[model samples]
Target: MLPRPPRTVQVLALWAACTATSLLILRLGAADTGATPWAGPAPSWGEHLRFWDAGWYERIARQGYPAVLPVDGAGVVQQNAWAFMPLLPLLTGLLTWSGAGFYPLAAVVCLAASAGAAVVLDRWLAPRAGGAASLWAVALVWSSPCAAVLQVPYGESLGLLLVCAGLWLAGRRRFLAALPLVALAALARPVGVPLTGALGLWWLMEEAQARGTVPRAALARLLPGHEVLEARQRRGLLVLVLGAATATAAWPVAAWLVTGRVDAYTATETAWRQGAAPDVLPWLARSATWVGPHLGWLLVLGVLAAGALVLSAPGVRSLGAVPWCWCVSYCLYLLVFFDPTSSVFRLLLPLAPAAWAVGRAGTRVRALLLVAGVVGQLFWVSWVWDRTVQMTWIP
Candidate 1:
């Protein structure tokens, strides 16, 4: 029998293969749709990377954020450059100014960040789930339909890298070391704020579990007759909690400072809804319209219940308190705030803990799931890429 390759080699090989296959799939889709994959008048390799939100990042890299927010007649802010985060554009801008084109440099940045995220996720999961599951997690992430965004000039890859790295570090109890990564992640996306909440919830759970009786530990700590939490552990937990809170506030605070509007970020984000505010009634109505009147509410309830079960299930719980908290909190956030569009799948990529559960399935089930994932990826890539090029939807 041949000796098996090292884990690192295996991961990189799988990632490369998946990436190549996705690009080929995109190419074939483009050919079928009679769409040109190139971006500009003069074609380049970078042009092949351009699609959907990639254009927004490219614009920000070429020209910084608007000095003034564009508003309509009714004084509602339009969806402008500020809706995008600054980190990716900042890095891409530096590259562009140094003679690199926006598309190519941004693509490089995204791809590298995604590769780093894959490594971190695998390393983080391996200790808890074993080597095979760790590799499976990486494979599943790479082959996900939404992973096409990772290949573009978007910030999702970088944000995922930072968030996963921080979560991994925090899981190992290196709270202080994880601070900067969490801070950078906050700057990368609004989801970063919720991630802090997830971390805090995990810390509270860990503290309660450490004492063996959650309610008694709480009462004892409140009464001051017993030390539910040791001085060192308490201080470490406080620092982590505080650091994450501060980091989560960094981006919105920066937006406020720059725009002189308290709701600058939120307001800009609202523009994407085209005047439809995030309300439960409207969400339910839309759900009904899509899924049918009687079944829509049932579907919503069923999905929410199923998601709750999956996040709290033994496999996910075994990953650790922090990962469990992150998955649960992130899913709830999506349910309340985000529209139920295809973008939800892309947004869920940050919840790497969920993948750990899927990775732990038996070999036959895992193989079946992977095959289904690839099929889904093929359909998603074809539909999304075609729509993006045709200017129908944002990828």
Candidate 2:
């Protein structure tokens, strides 16, 4: 059969190709690592699932506060400082209490929420772009690192769902409706700060456009309604800033309530495998370091996609001031206090939505960029999973 035209057959073809590629990557990652039921003992699936934040959260769920014990030769007791965000654990506890297993319940919740996120993305972008672009958007999200979120009992999926929902609402100018969801996103992850920042920038842009560059007296008379615009913009900014701040602060407050120290969450992070903060130049150099040895094409694709966003997309350029500001801020946060793998994925989540928006410019261009990203992401995941599975098996 003759190949169908791009416009006629692209969406389903793209979706199928992406899904198949994802499954293939997963399979390759699991080829030697056969199914080991019950997360086994050797640092593999046999042992308890990769404990990190999940373990800390589970412990908090089972034991609200640690028993009083002496600290630093003093009689003061140290409560578990990791009990910061109780929402995820509390939900887990409720599920376990109701006869559902924690891990399985968490997996189901993440999957459902992620699916909901894809639905929201489709609805938000469908009207602006053709169905082809919408399909690529949802497919790219599903194929991204966020999908791995479903397998782990982490808050990523829930956080992403709320963030996407909030953005979708904001696109429609429904500021009030987006608030609670954005708040939940903040509670789930700190990345909500950039999200709120994006909205604030939008408000500022609208205000600047309202205040024309004419003589103040003449302009004031010509535009008597400028005060109304300024007032509306101020209100929008306030709602976004306050809502995001409250949501992001929720976890720290919970930690303070449980443990006397207000900075307990930061302290707990340090207890993990914390790496040194990389300087900006060194970080870029390090990311560059991986380019030629194992995968040249992948690096090239990444650069091209990022360049395309900067050069081709009007929507991206429209938010040019805000996007770069948020991107740099996020990079600074990632450098200061997170490990390499954790920093890479967590920092990328919020930006992926922006990338998706930018990549929707043309059918062929979007398809090429989307495929490259999905393939490169899956390849990276495969290598990491292999090492992780091996460590589990050996341990």
Candidate 3:
């Protein structure tokens, strides 16, 4: 057999392939539906990148967010510009200010961020899994059902880049260096808050082990007892915690300053649910309406069981304390807070680390799973992207 290319080469090739395939799929869907890729009256390649949340980002870029929240005649908060985060729009605004068109610049920003994320994932996994396995992990992440989000102007690409890069830095014991990335990640999406929480939990677990007080058997075995953290570790942990807290508060605090309401961010987010309660019963009832009662409950239970099994996999459990903690904590956070709508798949993009567990399988199994993921991506793009532009679904 011939020698393999460097891991970087392989990863880049994979990222390019996946990105091109996604764009092709988007183009085909647009043609079939007689819709253009660009947002307005004319068709253009940039159209494919401007859908759903892309419009919000473009608006923020062209015209800054509202100084005050907008409310309808009924006193309900209408979808105001503040509902979205600032980082992506700020970047797009800078590009637009430089005389670049909004949609094209936004697409470039998203595509670059997406590629950077894949590279970071490869580097993070290469040490734990060999080159081949790490490559598989990257492939799986890019081929996820909602992977199309990476190609759009949405914040998921930038958010994933920060999360993965921060975690990778943390894995190398560069806690201080990871702090700023985590801070930025927190601003990218609400997932950053949980990401910081996970890092803190990891630090606590490390501290506990250092103090010879193991909280659980799994943790005890994962991190054998050692003397209390060196002065450096302790200092690093303090800085990380402070940075994370500040980052998490950045959005909420901004909202409060703008709207003079403590619940400004929460209220804007809740508006998307249209006043619907977040209870599981309501979700199940809604699902029942779409698919009969018997199948609906069964589907819910099946998803829960599958999630539990995946989380419990030995590979996932065996991850280094920080990654494991981050994964489990993030998953639990989503379960309680995120509504189980179709968007859940997109929301789950932060769980990219879980792909490592799948990559641990034998070559044949890994290949089959990768193929399945690619197929899922095609179908997901067709279903979500096609319908979302038609106003049939919310991406």
Candidate 4:
């Protein structure tokens, strides 16, 4: 019998097909505002997808962060390039520094990085979820609902790549190696903040177990903590956790250092909230306003319940301690800090571990999800890329 193709080859082929399809769908149509799809005068098809947050990245890539923060009439800092992470744009800027355009070259970079993310995720999940299950997980993730951003000039692709690399390394008790990748991932996106908790939880498990000296009962199942790990491993794990903390702080510190303002990053972030506090209340209000005041709390409770169910599923739980912690932490971060928005879907990309469960979920279920996800991609690509939807959605 002939040998099968390697998993990485399969992953790349799937990625290429999806990327080509997404670009084709985008090129064939821009966005229709009820009348017809609006194809703006952007030089290429990818340019149509590069707007909103892409515009901010393009600005950052074209000209670095402004030394002076832009402010409104009321002395409030308005949204600016500081609100977005620099790594994606800075990397993209490398190509554009030679006079190439921003979005097209960025599209290439994002495609390559996201491919790396798929391969990492494939290897990362294989041990925990068998080879077949891991392949299914990768397929589901690359073709997920908001897969559009995977190809666009967004941070999600590169950030996810780094985040998964960090998770893969950290899971194997390779703390020292994971730290710099985690830091670079942090530099790419806000997702690094949640990764800190993932690493911290792993450290706590190992550190607490190591201190016990007496063997821990296996039931509680504190992962990365086994009978074999020594004092040195525990110490290295602690370093990983602290390094995650420092990585999360790098952006804010850099923003402050550059702009010479203590509140540069926070002020810029809050500009979007228009002074709303970071809490569940804003999310509740948004939900209530969207649905109704009476059902608002129910809606919030329902989402929490749904997340609990999803995370607790056998497949997700099988992802083991570090990845599961990341899923929970990222969810908590979104719930606490974010108000509901269309962009929330894209923010859920890091939750790909759940797809492991979804993948193992019966063949029929996987097929259904794939179909729904494709439909979602078509809708999201056409809907979000359309300029008119920009007023209501942030994808």
- The best candidate by lDDT is 4
Clashes of each: 0, 14, 2, 3
Task: Please tell me which predicted candidate would have the highest TM-score against the true structure.
Answer: 4
Q: How accurate is candidate 1 locally (lDDT)?
A: 0.74
Candidate 3 colliding pairs: 37-47, 38-47
Would you list the C-alpha lDDT of every candidate in the order shown?
0.74, 0.54, 0.76, 0.78
> 1-395 in candidate 2: lDDT tens per residue?
99766642454455445545654565555554443443332333312233344555556667764433223344332334353455566666666756765655665565556556666655655555446556777666656653454345667667767777887776555678888888877766666556656666556555555665344454334323222235664576568767876777776676666567765555544444332223333334445556654464566457547655553355543333334334444544555444444336544665545554554677777667666666665644444443443433111
lDDT of 4 at 73: 88
* Candidate 3 lowest-lDDT run of ten: 220-229
What lDDT score goes with residue 372 in model 1? 76
Q: Model 4: how far is 255 from its true place, Å?
A: 1.4
Ranked by TM-score from best down, the candidates are 4, 3, 1, 2
Candidate 4 residue lDDT tens string, 1-395: 98988878987887777667666666654534333232345325655645668888888877889788989888889888888988888888678656668888888789889889888888888777777777777778877778878888889888999999998897787889998899999988987668887777666666665677434664145432233457887788788888889988888888999999988888888889996668888878888987899998888899999988877766676667777778888888898888788788888998887787677778888888877887887777666655445455667
Candidate 3 runs further than 4 Å off: 1-5, 35-43, 215-217, 220-231, 276-301, 388-391
Show the colliding residue pairs in model 4.
31-37, 32-36, 32-37
Q: What tens-digit string does per-residue lDDT give for candidate 1 at 1-395?
A: 99999887887887888777666776666555544443533223455567667777777767777666778999998987777888888877766556767788888888888888888888887878888888887778788777777877888889989888988887777778988888888777676657877887766765665766567645444332332445576567668778888877776677778888887777888888876666555456667877999988987888778887886577877776667777877887777777676676778788866787788898888888777767877777666655534444445
Higher-lDDT candidate among 3 and 4?
4
> What is the overall TM-score of model 1 with all chains considered together?
0.89
